[model samples]
Target chain A: EAGVTQFPSHSVIEKGQTVTLRCDPISGHDNLYWYRRVMGKEIKFLLHFVKESKQDESGMPNNRFLAERTGGTYSTLKVQPAELEDSGVYFCASSPIDTYGYTFGSGTRLTVV
Target chain B: GIQVEQSPPDLILQEGANSTLRCNFSDSVNNLQWFHQNPWGQLINLFYIPSGTKQNGRLSATTVATERYSLLYISSSQTTDSGVYFCAVNFNKFYFGSGTKLNVKP
Candidate 1:
């Protein structure tokens, strides 16, 4: 089976620009999550999705960030008016309900200048 | 939210040497996993050990859920082992430690 896949391994955008990151989870996986690691910081969870519905989103940093999972398959994270602080690596992971380990993607390195 | 702490923020080892990394959490966790981020920045899952001990070749991990700690052992270290090892604990959300940066020199 293919692992979780993320698009645009690297992205460069200007402050106040909008950027969208996409993730395609493994087949038949019900649980998908988003996380990010800023420079010199530990990775932090952003949100989670179970199928088409969001399971948890308390970790979302602000209103400028939005996530959606359509048709219970793939997910997209959009950052509106991106800030310089948003420069970091964004990772997506997927796991089956019965599995303990999650398969992670290569991550998207976002650079907002 | 629970706090995760990794000891010895950095470590250096010679090829073929062995090292042990530790992770401690402030609260109990139902899920704990170890991941290695390579130089090219890929998060590779090493182990999903919430409790007990598990071994895979030269790598082994033990998680003492009751004690709220986990240990990752890397034996016969290679240059490829040079990267960041992160321990993440899952409760309502996943909490990650700052990571232990390992450098293995040949």
Candidate 2:
């Protein structure tokens, strides 16, 4: 089966620009998560989705960031007027409910200049 | 928020050598996992060891939930083992350690 897939493996945008990162979770997985890792830092949770509903979004950093999971199949994280501090790797992961392990994507590297 | 710390921060090993990485957490957790991010930035799940011990091939992990600490052991390390190893703990949300950067020389 295909693993969690993330598009635009690398993205570069000017400061104050907008960018959207996409993720396709593995089929039949109800739990999807978004995590980000700044340069030389630990990965931090952004939010989570259970099917089409937002399970928990407490980790979202600020109002400039938005996430959506349509049909509970794919997810998109959009950052408007992204700041230079937003440069980092964004990873998407998915797991079946009650499962022990999570499958992660290759990650998208975003650079804000 | 919970605190997660990993040491020694960095590791250097020779091929065929063995090394151990450690992670310490500040709170009780329901999930503990180890992940290896290769040079290509692919996060691969190595183990989901919330407690006790588990072994897979040349890698093994042990998590003592009571002590809030975990250990990952790599035996007969190869050049391919050079990357970053991260330990993540989840209570409600996941918290990750800074990761141990490993460099294995051939």
Number of the top DockQ candidate: 1
* Candidate 2, chain B, TM-score (2 decimals): 0.99
At residue B35, candidate 1 shows an lDDT of: 95
lDDT, candidate 1, residue A79?
98
List, residue by residue over A1-113, the lDDT tens digit for candidate 2: 99999989999999999999999999999999999998769999999999989999998999999999999999999999899999999999999978757888999999999
| Ten-residue stretch with the least lDDT total in model 1 chain A | A95-104
Candidate 2: CAPRI quality band: medium
DockQ of 1: 0.76
Model 1: per-residue Cα lDDT at residue B61: 100
